[model samples]
Target: MAAGEPQAKKLKLEPKQLSENVLFGMGNPLLDICAVVDKDFLDKYGLKPNDQILAEEKHKELFEELVKKFKVEYHAGGSTQNSVKVAQWMIQSPYKAATFFGCIGKDKFGEILKKKAEEAHVDAHYYEQSEEPTGTCAACITSDNRSLVANLAAANCYKKEKHLDLEKNWKLVEKAKVYYIAGFFLTVSPEAILKVATQASANNKIFSLNLSAPFISQFYKEPMMKVMPYVDVLFGNETEAATFAREQGFETEDIKEIAKKTQALPKVNTKRQRIVVFTQGKDDTVMATANEVTTFPVLVSDQSEIVDTNGAGDAFVGGFLSQLVYDRPVTECIRAGHYAASVIIKRSGCTFPEKPDFH
Candidate 1:
């Protein structure tokens, strides 16, 4: 052994005291520019066929020219941000929420997000960076309200040092009863996730996660594996769940096995209850806890019309979290989640229903 060698200190986590009502989220904040376009518009813009495209200024200019031929709308978006917004609306109870993220140039997009948060009564504190333009997502919608293009940009710069002050923001995180995170962030910057997860562990936080996109699972196998033990509640759809199962070397066909394996993961704290919730479109949603497995049937409106499916998953997470934070029964929570998702699917974009009449 070298006598003069420096030694690395072992990381230690001590639980901090926290209230039972606050919630905090960490992720990217993006602006969504949504528009309904027909085949003519698609052809006029020369938007390549299939999957969303992230374009440069030239393409954006061309897109702008094409959109001038149709109608367009803009809204604030980002998976975690949307979830927090929906949760705030559904809870209808006074709750404190803090979001940590980077925004580009105090532009209209950033202003709109701040205004929307304020309108929803959410405490909006953000760090504005100057290197890049504010991030945006151009959602090209068809006449049927189905999204054909999701152009993402600028929102991809959330790095670890960007969250170095997170502990100082611990008051905001600890004041909240639950901490929500999205898998998309993990894919973007796992170091940022590790920073948050370590702090949440030390503070005895009820950590929750949503699989933001189906394909996120494929790119984040190791990172997800490392983060799961610190997670208290996990939300995902069928595609995400199957991807997770495959990543863990389990066959998707064996649902029971997947559930069992997921439930058996070590908990961050023994006193905490761990759960995995899988949402199957039009099929029953399944929840797995250490000692029990429950299935809740999806609630479908008698004459439901699909307007737009964007943010539906985020709405479901918001609904579930709103109920769960209040210590509602799992069954009721699942129902609330489905109810929220149903409402969003019948709307043009990610929006809260005027009323939560979940009978």
Candidate 2:
């Protein structure tokens, strides 16, 4: 599914002409507790601006502090969930255009996540449990930078047999033409990803994934390696690419070289060559295949209009997936991804307008 292959021939169809469950995404779903707070609040939590870290014992009070003292906003904030929501918004025709699967708790935060997913037109089927009280990320904003403290409460409790392997849910897996997951999910349920990726490859469908964060390559290498063979389209930023290259013993930090090597990795499914996309903030986006490396300059924004940089990567992939499901070419997918990312960076959190005005 390299954007210009025979499979891409499906691009002849309009973007909105897709059926329900056209795209399927799975990962941890977290409620984003977002608000603008002063430097004193950040110092109190021993957090610095622009830092993303798991919640520590010392930071346990931050979520409540944000809710108690500041004007906060909540948005559905998991990486895969955000992408599918953006994809649904871009497609905008058949409601429930994108289907998402994840585990959450039977708590208020989980309720909010479901409500937000519905509001975004994403068909969410969450595995609700009571042992833990939903996962959340406190997005403490100071000017343009955000400090994130995530509490992966129920997010870590995903068991494959409980949801993904069920007959009723597996039907959605079979019905989708494109399957996506964030590498962050490797921490929660790589077994579930293996199940979906194997099925997607066996069925000759497009299977895409992201190197969600740098630590994923460093800490989750075993699971990442097990599923890499089934990936047709891989997305990440230059930073994550460099980290993956170093961690996988690729021995190079140059993104073009890394992309070329990644494309050449052993793939079980021989239908198409793996295509890798690495985004460079404020520089050219690099796309690589077995034959060539191409670059696309990103849209530039003024310093005054930028609101938040969080969720830009997920938004980019969502926009790309919107076109991929429609069989749109790789170039168009990149353009749409850029459009989506640009729109999101102008707003707070991963929230988007009612409809996308993609040209």
Candidate 3:
């Protein structure tokens, strides 16, 4: 199931079974330029291993230096983009099963991202802005760990008026059965989240939100709260879940406790139970539903097979959401999520092989 590994077998769901469900995603859109570097590269760039840093003007020279020294590979990234890609792969129909929305600059990197997404079979609807260059995330990998420097650039131009309602975008929103928005979007456009949440609510669709990172929960608390009631399915890692809990005056760092506390929050959609999925890397993934909190251990491959853990969590959400659209039970959803994560961690960047081994 590793990206470059030999195909084990052909495994896929029937096209007819997949055509009925549609998922929508809106969030930061970036082209990830990745390369393997020596451990000293981190100290040279002042980057902490495994941390996601916002790229500032000062990092421009560092980017230039990396490109000069290493072979680079590009993938369509940004957390929500990664999730949508994995979900589309799981469903086996990118055009029919998923649609992603984001803003990008009318430049070469944007063109690259658009082309790569199409190649991956995702329905990529990008709002092209002439004002800025395409955003990018420089992911430097060393010894299987990744550190990222994200340049928001034109990706941050995701305003409600500029992108959401243009042409057939609103129609796509109306037809979707599930809606997903990355937490990073809150920093750029909270109004976009509200707009999509409102529409998803009116349409009785499933609205899912990924906490993105811990800083998002800390810095964007108000907007996170504003959209929380509308989020029927909430996703976050151990760090993100604990951060949100601490922000709300909870002293506990336990994953199960965090899931319980989040699941108890009031929801706008009363008919649907609030499901909080808390993931602890290499540990059990906790699912908190109306009745109880259940834990499922991550199904990892042999340790030697784990290559780059870059998009593992996002892949998990994609896998989970892929099954969510099919009304699968929570246990099955988590299993699918784990499978997707297992595959992505075996590959570089957020890239996937031509056909995943589903068995």
lDDT of 2 by residue, 300-328 (tens): 88878889877888999999999999888
For candidate 3, the lDDT comes to 0.86
Name every residue pair that clashes in candidate 3. Answer: none
Cα RMSD, each candidate: 11.7, 5.5, 5.7
Off by over 4 Å in 2: 1-16, 46-48
Q: How are the candidates ranked when ordered by lDDT, highest leading? A: 2, 3, 1
Candidate lDDT (C-alpha), each = 0.68, 0.90, 0.86
Ranked by TM-score from best down, the candidates are 2, 3, 1
Candidate 1 lDDT, tens digit per residue, 119-225? Answer: 76556556566556666766666643344343334456554565445565545555666778888777567776776676777777778887666566677778877
Residue 349 in candidate 1 has what lDDT? 70
lDDT score of residue 158 within candidate 1: 56
TM-score for each candidate, following the candidate numbering: 0.82, 0.93, 0.93
